[model samples]
Target: MTEIAPIAKPDRNRPEPLWHQAEQALRGLIADGTWTDGMQIPNEERLSTMLGVSRITIRHALRNIEDSGLLRREHGRGTFVRSSTVIAGVRGLTSFTQEMAGLGLIVGSRILERDEQAASAEVASALEIRQGEPVVRLRRLRMGNDAPIGVQTAYMPLARVPGFLALEPSASLYQTLSAHFGIAPREAREVYRVGTVAAEDAALLGIETGSPAFVVERITSDAIGPFEFVHSIMRGDRYEIRSRLHI
Candidate 1:
């Protein structure tokens, strides 16, 4: 079989950062189907030569790609391309940030809505709070490696989490709740369903209107009572629900 030339070649003379260029080239290989899933890529030394960069540069590029969940590295075995689709396990009451971090993907959030509102009937019912009770509504566009992954809207009773709205926009909800408010979920129930996202959610998730998506509804309760209710819309193309079954 003939050797396949890399589709993207890093330009040494270009003013752009060399490691970033190398990363783009490597990512291009995977995106274009030249380097397939589970295929072990060249060694750092060989990649350095092919990309016209130093071993350190190649290493940095590989690390970035790996952090995006597109590659996995073994010490004895070489680095290999992971599947482009991200596997999000639903086995626990895990936060979005924690889940992405577990998969080696960088998590980011852009707060789309953060304000106190009287609980609607649906929200009241989910959180087991009285209707018209004040609650904190936090809606965010969740991203993994700067790519849109999901849109999440969470509601928490103001009595349980006072001053939560003052936190930073990108702060992890669970961490802040546990650290500042002394709240933790003792038990949680999550419902997952396949549905199409509306135009607003689709735009936030960077997908087309009415795209296939996963609608996840969750109610997290502490020892005292239910404290949080969350609804999330996850992109179907890039996300998969995974769990390890026990006998």
Candidate 2:
């Protein structure tokens, strides 16, 4: 276990709250690699004593840091520094496999369910298909470097891609679509929001229910028309979204 050095005492004359100062100090430790990933950090009592602050202040600081996705706290255990976030760029029309591969992480998928079903109202609207039309539904647990990172459910109109359900379980959906059907995603629009993990998805991602996560809803289209609708829940502690904009 790496011993965390005591933080400097926050000046009482400073306008910042003690808890805020403590949080910044801890963040600096993480940024400097003093606290590596998965290493247990000092407990609240020890931090309070070392920093000359109340235990309440230390607790508040730890909670804030944990919420910011830098720490994972376990009941009856201790807080551990989590891995750095995987940044997803908004400019790409890439699949999860492509994105993770670019970071040199091994990507794996476990198909939870796949079936041909009538499209629901939401799916139909997103794919620009008529309601009750046949669609191939795929639910998958997405893994990066052998660690579960997200759960994604995708719907595609059956008319657009026939025989999709016959593909191998572990094959990349995008690659299969491109190679067989010549359907490639040319553009995608995604909306991102924060939410607590639902029970089913939490189990699939191996996280506690109610853990913070990123909810991404995406609609993908080719030059012809919209064809795919996807909803994904990414682990907040392991992923972050990045976008570049030109002024």
Candidate 3:
């Protein structure tokens, strides 16, 4: 579980309404994954204290957020963050961590496999590395709100990301790569297939065998060239891809 960040106090001096600033501060918590799915939030009074605002302002902000489908208010109960869909933009090159965080979902990973292995022909082709070259492989069971969402296996050239095996897979791989290895993906090509989940992936994702799934293969390139190849099997019921069309 991630630490929840404290809500920032709204500035009364700003031209924006106090309720609006309070609303944006609360929304910022949701957007950054601090206020996660299905989690009950502080009461209006508590929120008022935290944000240094009156209960009335907090109430107005909470009502606006609830009306927008970001929260649910139950009678005699507290407001809870809504369990939102795991959505990704079709045109974006985003890591699973960033994608989930944007939707206020805390992403968790159960490491299934982590080892150095010889690159398979397909992986080598995708990464533009020689076949049989050493590669670092990390396989993870991806989770949201403690529910299984997908199984992702990523491969990178061992030479490019040395000592990657030592880092915890719970953190974002792309962030680690950029911070430690100075490698960042600039472009990505993804191929999505609608298919039935295999027994292995189904077991990891807590779904029945032959359940519908989206099989995605992605080849990502840094400044030098292709460096990462990833395969993901996402539960069809839990994931969605959105893209805005250009007219």
Q: Tell me the tens digit of each residue's lDDT in model 3 across 140-220.
A: 888876778889999999999999888765468899899889998899998989989998888888789999988899999
For residues 15-98, write the lDDT of model 1, one tens digit per residue: 999999998888877766687767888888878777778999999989888766688778887788774446766456678888
Per TM-score, the best of the predicted structures is 3
lDDT for each of the candidates?
0.82, 0.84, 0.84
TM-score of 1: 0.68
Count of backbone collisions in candidate 2: 0
Lowest lDDT 10-residue stretch of candidate 2: 82-91
**Tens digits of per-residue lDDT for model 2, 31-97:** 6778877899888888888888999999899887775556887888888987444567654788888
TM values, all candidates: 0.68, 0.67, 0.68
For candidate 3, what is the total of clashing residue pairs? Answer: 0
lDDT for model 3, on a 0 to 1 scale? 0.84
